[model samples]
Target: MTVIRCPGLLNCDVVEVPHGLRLLAADGRSYLLRGLSADRLAEGPLPAPLAHALDRLGLLRAGPTRTVAVVGSGRLAIDVAEALRGVPGTVVAELSDDPATERPGGSWQLMEDHSPSRLTPDLVVICPTDPLGLRPVLQLCRERRVPAMMAWCGPASAWSGPVLTESRPGCQNCLDMAMARRDPLWLATAAGLTGAASCWAGRSWIAGQVAGLVAAGCDEAAWAQPTWASWTPRGHSSAPLDPHPECWWCCQSGPAPVRAESECSAVSSSAA
Candidate 1:
């Protein structure tokens, strides 16, 4: 099997310490290479044992650079962008609803339009502070067949999950359907909500989780699963987001025919 240094480790600074080589990773972690030389590792023909060890440690693998679009506003979005910036081989872009507003000192460029046609990204990470703001973006992802992952904060909790994709069994609509089945009034209640929820305490933690998910999604062999996770004051819980049998999004023939915004809203309102 062909082995190469993990794309994530590409940005590490290789230092020749007295004892051996110390690789300083962007995340502030260091790896000590005892007998191996950086040049040899980079050049080729690594020993089988060494290659296996590095692969196990996630320091060696084959992966291409991925363009990831993060859509949303507020601290969580910024936090997710900041975390993704440290991940090598991942180009991060911020898609904002507001064209005039730009984040100061942000490393990534601000995309004025959230349209997938404008910037076709390998994946989209959505972590808006307000859950209700997700509808339009979810609709866009559905219409464009763009894969998306969502992370958000609730009044007293934080959530990351249900990575949506055209190839996946569950989409955001299925999630809404699942929610409606559990709580018949969920859509109505969600419609009434206004401002974003505050997740001051767990913003960074949830952002890290989302960033990690983005990284995993970039690997061809590590396709993200439609799983949902929630962090509450009480504890953490996670489960698979299965496709709803009656979901119009994934259960239909091809892709759900692009519907008008008002028509989509009517369907959701009726589902509730």
Candidate 2:
């Protein structure tokens, strides 16, 4: 058990990470939350100037000079706001629609209820709890030409790179495939995600880290370093484009040919 008192705690409303764990006090709480880093840390080693960099150069600092409105109150959204405090952007948690769905591009409008003229977001962060929030907003962001990214939340079957609007390789559908292949144990608990509040503290931490990537990806300087990495170990599999014609999204050159009887729906790339 090692601990470091963070000086950065003096400025922020709360204690910063790697140091804040000591404040949790409960052994179990500390245990479940420890050693999640993809990189290893030796005990009692000198703490990096992490607290300082985290205080100054977190998610928001990586974003555009424009006001950044963090849309949802989900763990990632709140964590992004928390990490980006005093970084010169307006952060809001009002994008919930009824409860789960966030009004897509609410950040551009500067309000949860009002729709923006278009999804030309300087940066849009999606932390959808389920596909209900994911698909609709993804479709709309595509329609409006928003350069957006999705927060990596849970275990994925194959996993994708930083979900980016600029490229198709690093997209949500790849992450979706990764999830389908993973073992259910990866879900953690039935409350693997019960609500915005009840999810495992560990999961919350994971979401926050990935959301940090989402934040940093928005800022060109941060992303140029290529610092972001996956939160968990991933299994790899070959997913090739269909030899047969495909949907307009994936195969732009050729429209998918009509299917034979019992073909049912289009075969997902994961199957290929």
Candidate 3:
């Protein structure tokens, strides 16, 4: 396997200290190399043992560049894109249905075409202001077997995850089913809302959290269990989303055997 020095450390400054060489990376992180010479840090193939060590130390990166499509609108989407641009070996492209709206500090290319057929990203991060508007895109991703995750801020809350994929146990449809089950009027309530619901306070802190979640989800070796992170004014929390037995997306075989009403209540209470 070929391994190269981390691109984020390409412009790192190496200073000789009394005991070892200290590398100040471009991302403002510092590393201490006890015995290795600075010359060994060249961007080239590294021996297996050295590559393994450097990789463990976060000084090396291997694999092809990943293309990530960020689909959404508003400052949160742009902020997430900006944050992802800093990740090594990542290519980010922003896609929005509303091109007429102005996006500030959006240096990344805005793909005017919002067609799902035109995109083949390794992973899609959906953080649109109004998630309901992106339901069709989510369906397309499921059909194409493309991995995707969602991160967005609500009027008084923020959420991330349950990263969806072909083999994942749970999906957006399951989530919607669970929501509707928990609140019988959820679908009706969601329909009455307009695009105005997509706007949030635009907190930088929330953007960082959402971006971090999206970045972790991009990892190919990430955990397979479907979980979501949520934040409120009071604090933050996360929970695994179990697949709805009747979900048409994941439980295509058929609905699981129904449990007693008490048993159903227990399961819902635990998930809550």
Candidate with best lDDT:
1
**Candidate 1 residue-wise lDDT, 169-191, digit = tens:** 77666666676678767656665
Q: Write the per-residue lDDT of candidate 3 for residues 1-272, one digit (tens) a residue.
A: 22234333334456666555676665678877676544554533333334435545565435457788877776677777777665555577777635575444232233223576555778777765653456556656666667877676666666676778776678766676676789766655555543445334434445555445544446645747888777777777889999988665686633334556542343333232
Best candidate, TM-score-wise? Answer: 1
For each of the candidates, the C-alpha root-mean-square deviation to the true structure, in angstroms, is 8.4, 11.3, 9.5
Candidate 2 structure quality by residue, lDDT tens digits, 1-272: 53433222222122225633322322232222243231222232112234223434331123234334344545555554454443333243334423444544334233222355332445555655432244455545555545445543444311223333434433444343334334343233323443434234434454445434543335554433212233334322234322122233334423334655221121232122
Model 1 stretches astray by more than 4 angstroms: 1-63, 103-117, 191-193, 219-221, 254-272
TM-scores for every predicted model: 0.67, 0.45, 0.63
Better of 2 and 3 by TM-score: 3
Name the better of 1 and 3 by lDDT: 1
Q: Which pairs clash in the backbone of model 3? A: none
Best of the two (1, 2) by TM-score: 1
List clash counts for every candidate, in order. Answer: 0, 7, 0
TM-score of 2: 0.45
lDDT, candidate 3, residue 90? 59
